[model samples]
Target: DAVYNILIDRWTKSSTPIHCIAHSLNPWYYSKEWINDVSGRVSPHKDMELSEERNKCLRRYFPDVKERRLVNQEFDRFSGGLDAFGSFDSLEDRWVLDPKAWWLVHGSSAPILQNLALKLLGQPCSSSCCERNWSTYSFIHSMRRNKISPKRAEDLVFLHTNLRLLSRNDADYKQRESKLWDIGGDAFDSFDNGAGVLEIASLSHDEPTMETMLFTDDED
Candidate 1:
């Protein structure tokens, strides 16, 4: 009972209307096999909490009454297995494809809901990515480098983050025996190879910098 209480507390704190809406739109929750395997519960559409949270999300996402009504209509069609959503191919693909891809293929009938689904479903449910960015930022602006200007630190963090991302996709990174990519350690550790940091820093000037693209809107 203690464990159940803890779980419920955590869930109550973390769960939001967006999370509820995402779960409501997820195809797997509607699968008989999945539903039976888990709780043998009613359909997600029938879940009172999910239904209420979905309505909350609808109000927040569509302030215009007409747009909200259209979205609600589309939601009804989706939940009821009407029209395109009712087809065999759509249900079959639900089991085979990921949420975003499934929506892309079958979501044409409900463009507004599809757009919302794509945006919400594509999001990560955790703060780990943001934490990693802050970790990188901290490493760059540590006591030893406290003199670094905010703009310079920001640029460095951007470069470091993108470099790690790019390297993970590189053929050489994939073939490495260690396979533990970040084993090199933190704070631009991946570049500890024979390649000098200064050499890579020089390349940033040669191409379009992240500063131009990331902060352009702020400049306006």
Candidate 2:
């Protein structure tokens, strides 16, 4: 409870109206008061009113007059009844559906909010996946085979990563491979004929060295 209070205090201090608006769109958090405590730290109704005010401020800069009108109409619909915007009868069911997909399919009445939800919800909060991809790139473009052209290296990396992702399911893997072959039959044939040996050599050297294993604490 002490840690939660500290965290919430920091979060509330740093938070903007945009953050509040995003939280309001999320079904799970929609019913939650701005501050979920009995103590008078924040007023939930006042916070909601502020969020709506911020939303209005955000809408003022719309360059397109037609879009502005559409947004206002959507807001009217949303204010009238939250349930009127989506097909789902219950918020519980909406919680199970992908938030972006739900907004895209069901937010026709609230186009501006839908677009905002899609943008906000789809944002990546961390660069961990990008860092991992860079690690993979280092393995693919090792010091020895650094002669590989940037374009060819990119294509190889794309194929390698996507093929690995598809490998879990045999049928899907084969289907994707067949589709790739159909699209770039000549390129694949050329790669097989010319770069097969070079690729194998690259993969051989790409294996983790003893030092790498020691640093990573990997026994195998």
lDDT, candidate 1, equals: 0.76
How much does candidate 2 score in TM-score? 0.45
Number of clashes in every candidate structure? 0, 0
Superposition error at 109 for model 2 (Å): 3.1
Residues 24-110, candidate 1, lDDT per residue (tens digit)?
888777766666776648777999988998899889889999999999999898877789999998877777788889899999999
Query: Which tens-of-lDDT digit does each residue in 1-220 have in candidate 2?
Result: 9999999999876466766656556543432232354555443224666567556545654667788777666655553435565444433345456666666666766767778778877766556457556756887899998999988888887887787656534554234455323212445444345423333233333433522532344344
Candidates in order have lDDT scores of 0.76, 0.56
The pairs that clash in candidate 2 are none
* Candidate 2, lDDT over the whole model: 0.56
TM-scores, in order shown?
Answer: 0.69, 0.45
Q: Give the number of colliding residue pairs in candidate 2.
A: 0
